[model samples]
Target: MNSHKQLFILSCLSLVLVLLSGQFGLQVEAGHHIHHRSKKLFVFGDSYVDTGNTNKSKPGSWKEPYGITSPGKPTGRFSDGRVLTDFIAKYLRLRTPITHRLWDYTVPKHSLKYGMNFAYGGTGVFDTSSSGPNMTAQIDIFNQLVQENVYTLSDITNSIAYVSVAGNDYNYYLATNGSLPGFPSFIASVVNQTTINLIHLQSLGFKRIVVGALQPLGCLPQATAQTSFQSCNSTFNDLVTLHNNLLNRSVTKLNQEINDHNTFTILDIFDGFRTVLNNPSSHNIKERLKPCCFGVSSEYNCGSVDENNVKKYLVCENPESTFFWDELHPTQAGWNAVYNELEKRGLYKILY
Candidate 1:
């Protein structure tokens, strides 16, 4: 027998031995199967958790300097580093889920592996000034894919959905002659509509849905910069608490109404934001009320450009030590702190 032929036979024998041993190759195969069995994450929400699903042609995400920390360039995420979704994915031991718009950009198997992100920035539960799809339309997009068999019924049955309203609807209401005096009614309307959406998602086969409560809007850098970032406007937080209380009760009621053992959950972004904002010093954060990135002048807002097209916004010396990254969102580190709190408080227990 030729030496080459003998080597080939030996290689085949070695492969058989490895398979029978169940030490390396078989273990790898079993591990892969287990990973696939884990819950797939599906995200739907506004700017706070949008991972680049916005229109790229416009100045929306996927532009310069947005993803400077993680992907080293703009990748459509609304943070300098990771966002809430990223932390959630990490907790689940899964990759950052792909955005719905970028679904075609990834491999077909990958698109189905962790589910798709339907969240778009500048959107609300109802219609908004922006032309993008509202919460109902976003769910329609998901349904269209289901009809096309892009995702199987069983795939969705085991999947987890994350929804974030993030106060866009309220902002829209305030912008269009909606006064604070009538805001409670508006809040009730929004939560009622959102409850309908959550039920629809459950009917569509989602195992568990997680929704976020409104954050401390008045404490955001955009609001508190008027006070020189020295203090949070308690009036704003008061409104937020009212909204959150209503939202929590609405979610709890939904969980009770579900016919099956399954339920929709709420992640209290309101308390999560407040916990960080109330004690920024504990997190080594200096300015809890000031955004890390700000316009060169008070008249301007974040993402402002100068005469030479240079960015006029200033990023703080230590982004990790700040809560607000820009006008509305939190920094990656800021979110990490919040996620830690959520984990400590059992908000993410069912998510993974």
Candidate 2:
């Protein structure tokens, strides 16, 4: 071969090698990005995400029919099966972290890799009808764990915090005979405190935080039961709308001030629930307002047994077809449907 031709062939081979290496590098980078999307999940807030955090003997979540759809028994989740935390963990491809209450000194150190769930069923940003830890107290416990070195800074930096305040405080307010005029102020207070909690989570080293907007409280079975589960109370949903609006604004302001558009995100449970309820067929939900399990009368609820061991409440034949499992919490299928909606609307951003 001529010297010039040999030189040209050698240069072409070198160029091909470079291109291959660049392609390989890109693939490896993409793989790493996918692998480390979220190393852990730190969950907070109320019953919506409470995966066995509430005490066993206290909340009805620890009783029968709560985990019937998933674990085949009650596992402290306030649903017929999995809740939001379970769905979020599945999305992140991580094991659902054990509840913080279960994180005793005896568990293996390596178990913390999945992170911890600090949510307590029926609790809120502040105290609620339940005696479980409030959102502030939940954060305090997390902070204490950080101080005790239960989780390193790197773990938190790679983790996502899922906070859910599902309007229990408002329920308590109304139940306690809180004035109608004071409802707005109470909503504002809840949102303000929740904003503080999210900021504090950021300060604690959580790189990404997801805060849930309140769902339609008026549409819950507790409210609709008055109308024979035929219709939702618009007045109560109006209060929920006001709360969600304030919460959305607060999250927007926080993201703006933090200067990281993805640092804080709102899960928009309000809209998610509304969409599911308004168009139940789209989500395969046959019964939107009526709970799958409920008391035969006003004094009992799902999983309630009579003194003579007779069942006081009745459970539906197919929980998957029902949106609500009880008066307050949704069935497992219900949460899965909502998660699908959120995932369709860019839940990946929070995970990645």
Candidate 3:
């Protein structure tokens, strides 16, 4: 009787094992589907979205104290850590795409499966002071890769393009002695060029393309530094609003022209920055204007060092508590907060 009971128990255990295996298989399949549907991310634009594609010898992003928050070292990101592109890729459940400049030597060609970043710091849609690849040049590189069959047609169709022009063009204009009274016309010209760039991307067969609206230039540390970081210059912000309005109309027109509402989206980065800055407590930021790092005086800037290799810039005690990282860029924490706000505003569903 004991031997018979033992045989019956063994048979029951085998049946339970089969049931557990079936359940595990379902979980695995679900995860696989999510990953496959996530698709790829292709990034473009200036310092706001650049992920280390600039010249290594450049003094800004690749210098010391630039990436002290996360990596604990500089990695060509203008912030203390990852920038907007990294966070956007994270939202899409994809790897932060590799820097386009690092492809042949440092990065393996097989890594192209995630997509590539063609953004260069300090670049604009038109030429800028940074003397880097403009938006058109960046697109040319992407086109070359496509022609070489580096990315399959399936990859192109499934991927989303992220374009972040920010305010570099306006900065270039102001610095180049462009007349202020004629600024509105200049703003129109900038928007027109940007629209052309968007159409060019669409012509390349991108099913979905998201571009960032110009953020509030008044709130940047560079502008607020005059007020000892106490107040923003509303004049700059008004100009920013003009740029954003024109950009919104342009994007809407593009979608209507293409007959696909989902084809082009204007990611309201301006709103994202304003919302996060206005509600610091909501995002755990102590203040929004003061930068996390800066040089000792006006003669120098973030990442500045003395002749003897001594650091000239001062970094905040805790970068996670700050918003802006330097005169122009946001810290990793700041970008995270902006990403959260954008997500709350439906960036996910709009993109995917």
Candidate 4:
């Protein structure tokens, strides 16, 4: 071969190698987005991300099918596998935090290393039908630990807080004779209290505080199965809109108050969820509103079992295709999608 032709072929091979390396670099960067942050995650609120924080003796979450996808048995989390907090921690390069309920008996040394998870499943900003501690009480526990020096001011200053209030308070309202006429007043009260909680977390010195906006409750499997899961009930989503607006305004005002630090951010789970639901195929999801697991009837749930160790809830043929893990929560993959959307939109940028 001529010398010029040999050099040309070598140059072409070099170009192809560069392209392949560039593609690999992009994947590494995407993966780092979830695992490179310095701030540790401290989760709060309902089953959307609860990691065994509920009482186990009551058949709450430590039962069959709860952790089937991850641990192959039930853990305290309210999903078939890892929940939202797990993915958030994975993004931050930290371990999935220990639940406060279980930490009392387990390893106490590592409790303060990665921060503590004060979230309780089935709880809300206010007292709900479920008998878990409300958000106010949960914050109190976080505060008590700080006072006891279990978590120092420096630890809190370096840590990030993730608070998720996923409509348990609203459900409580409807369960207790709450009517449409009184919903606005009730919602206002709920958001008002939630704002206080966020502000209080900032006052306690968390570098970044993320409060998740309400998800599309009306589109949950329990609600949609009534309509054959063909479409979402717009009325329920309208209520969600009102809640999100109030939350956005409250977070905005709070951020203004902390202008120097810029310590507060809204996670906007509402819009992130809506984006996936509206464009499921783009996200590799086929069933946006349908749950991966559901009760055989309205009377049962994801963990309910038959006499022969058989699951009562009907699981979807493919969980990765669906956004919801059950009637009320998102699957691990579903939450990964939400977390990515939140990060892509600059929601995780923590200043000061």
Candidate 3 per-residue lDDT over residues 158-226, each given as its tens digit? 889989888888888989898889899999988899888888888888898998889989999999999
Pairs that collide, model 1: 52-76
User: Which RMSD values do the candidates have, in order?
Assistant: 8.7, 5.3, 7.3, 7.4
User: Positional deviation of 324 in candidate 2, in angstroms?
Assistant: 0.7
What would you estimate as the lDDT of candidate 3? 0.87
Task: For residues 271-299, write the lDDT of model 4, one tens digit per residue.
Answer: 88888788888768888877888788877
Which 10 consecutive residues of model 4 have the lowest summed lDDT?
26-35
Of 3 and 4, the candidate ahead on TM-score is: 3
- Could you give candidate 2's per-residue lDDT for residues 1-352 as a string of tens digits? 9999999999998787667656643222332234353379899988899888788878388888778888899899889899999998997778999888889635787778899999988888888878888999999999999999988899899888999989888889988999999999998999999999999999999888998888998999999989999999999989998988998888889889978888888888887888889899998899999999999999988888887978888899999999999999899999988888887787767567
lDDT for each candidate structure: 0.78, 0.86, 0.87, 0.79
Worst 10 residues of 2 by lDDT: 24-33
Higher-TM-score candidate of 1 and 3: 3
Q: Each model's TM-score, in the order given?
A: 0.85, 0.89, 0.89, 0.85
The candidate with the higher lDDT, 1 or 2, is: 2
Which clashing pairs does model 4 show?
34-91, 35-91, 52-76
Q: Which pairs of residues have clashing backbones in candidate 3?
A: none
